[model samples]
Target: MATAAATIPKDLSRLEAQAAGVLSPEALAYILAGAGDAGTTRANAAAFRRWKIKPRKGRRPRKVDLSTTILGTRMPAPVLFAPVGVQTLAHPEGDLATARAAAELGLTYLHSTQAAYKMEDVAAANGDGSRWYQLYWPTDDELTKSFLRRAKAAGYTHLVITLDTTLLGWRPRDLDRGYSPFLENKGIANYTSDPVFQRKLVAPANVAPLPAGIIFSGVFQNPGLSWDQLPLIRSSWDGPILLKGIQSPLDAKLAVEHKIDGIIVSNHGGRQVDGAIASLDALRPIVKAVGNELPVLFDSGIRTGRDVFKALALGADAVLVGRPYLYGLALGGQAGTHTVMQRLVDELETEVRKAGRRSHRSLSRSSLIRTP
Candidate 1:
């Protein structure tokens, strides 16, 4: 059965331009710009353009099905709102707007460990919407356990352990402007609200009095983190575990060996590395490594429905959208977020049908061709 057309402005380019008027210059540049010289950032979108779909003709009159299930949770599209932190910089409502929007759309949203609001509040906004918790893996064991415990209690269905960012990367754009959201205590509501983290607070906790790095350094990134520590998180979070930022086939295989539930093929949306390979370029091998064993959620370089379709064809079970919805939120709040996401789903279903595929799960490498 055909669904109604997307209600809001689905055109990303137009929506983004509209957002520029609504957001601050610092916020605008921060979300759009990438790391270092931004070569890999450009490459993410460029890589998609290099590949063309080999259209299959003479399809039957059957309608395409965009419905899919991940970890047994059924969704209307093979898409999820990726965990993008510090959303308060984009909108006052922050993760709450996102949570409410996802719930209304029946879409799955991954809540960031560093979200601006407390996890419980975001969960309340979700109101039975399927959601996952993305863990940054704080160095403090008890603190980490506290976060996991709260998420499980909040109705989060999965745990996404982000593994690649042991330390923040060199992003020239943010550096040039002396803009760091953490330093402002913008996205640490989850941490600050935590009883464990609050107990560690000393000399009073305020954004201006102390830099976030000073307080968060110990807990933010554990450079020494390795597979040895995976058990710690596993023991804490009993639900499904997905290790985000697995770019290599070896890492994908290792995750399977570690008995992980899924791996998000990402390069932190070209924010972590300067000259890294495009995430889509890295997806094929990782999928080849362990696509059958666990779900491979692809992130980075996804701006449109065609991008989502291309990622699905390349091997991702589902794709995560990062910045676009934030742009929408900047422009129109919860309604904007819903419109952008729904637009992507609308476009993805349109792409699946155009490529002559019945279901998104049926999309394969044969559906696309890499152009020279």
Candidate 2:
């Protein structure tokens, strides 16, 4: 259905540019915008350029094992679809298309709390795929619990609590265009479907998008959220709980102190802070701090398979690709998303072979050298 009008790009590098031709001005700006000046976004790509992969001599194995397990969830490759909200902005199928693609590819798909479709619908499409739910941690406790319960019931195996977006960042592009998807009620399906959330509404979300959107923005995040309150979530969720938006070694230690399952080193893809440290630059220290106590996943500025290789070499157990796959969705819907992600995995494997590595486990800090 997605590929009917357009031929999906195989090169992958040309995805965003091609997608620009297809996306509306508003959708394009919202999807591509970074906070403030987008300096951190630029740094994300620049950080990857600072590392040079060191190919081994005559030690390449004939076969590479890209498969791995994250907190007991098995994935065919080290790549995961980072939780991207409002996918409907890019494709009509939205999370459903991505979920089906992830299921078919045997990769993990992290569904966002701000998803365009309700959790159950995406799960139905996912059909027992390795899926995780990324939470925005609403101010209302019941709403938070309701979201987790829905996710668990729908077969999502993990919980990723995004700590950065307690308040939406000052994105200049969106502001310049006087656009906000939430205001348009574009990504409120999860909330609109929630029983707890409904009690707070005067009218059904579908019937009252404007009002529902206003309430969503108000309750979307808890600025007062603290480490001590993590147990509230842990008690509600039985699966592995990973804290997304972790950028500091001190915070990584704190996650260990809180007995969290894992930490994703991300700056919310540079969408939250304009001058924040690049996620890749932050990975090595966070990995060093946490060691093997918890899995360290990475996202932000991961544009290609080589970027994935760089992340693993820097000690990330696995990596998540966000914008790249969304670009795929923008261009070809499910097939486009699949093609982009598959290309990443394929390129990652090719990079491993070229770098004389045999397995994701074989990658280490020695496999790369920091460029001056």
Model 1 per-residue lDDT tens digits across residues 1-372 = 011123245566466676777889889878877788888888998999998888778774378888888888888888899998989888999999999999999999899998989999999999989999999988899999999999999999899989878888888888989888777777888888888887777744563335444677668977889898987887887888889998899999999998888889999888888899999999998888798999999999898898898999998889899988998788677888888888888888888888777888888899999997
List the lowest-lDDT window of 10 residues for candidate 1: 1-10
Clashing pairs in 1: none
Q: Count the backbone clashes (under 3 Å) in each candidate.
A: 0, 0
lDDT by residue (52-147, candidate 2, tens digit) is: 988667866788889998899988899999999999999999999999999989999999998999999999999978899999999998989999
Candidate 2 residue spans exceeding 4 A from truth: 1-6
Model 2, residue 285: C-alpha shift (Å): 0.9
lDDT scores of the candidates, listed in order: 0.85, 0.89
Task: Write down the TM-score for model 1.
Answer: 0.94
Clashes of 1: 0
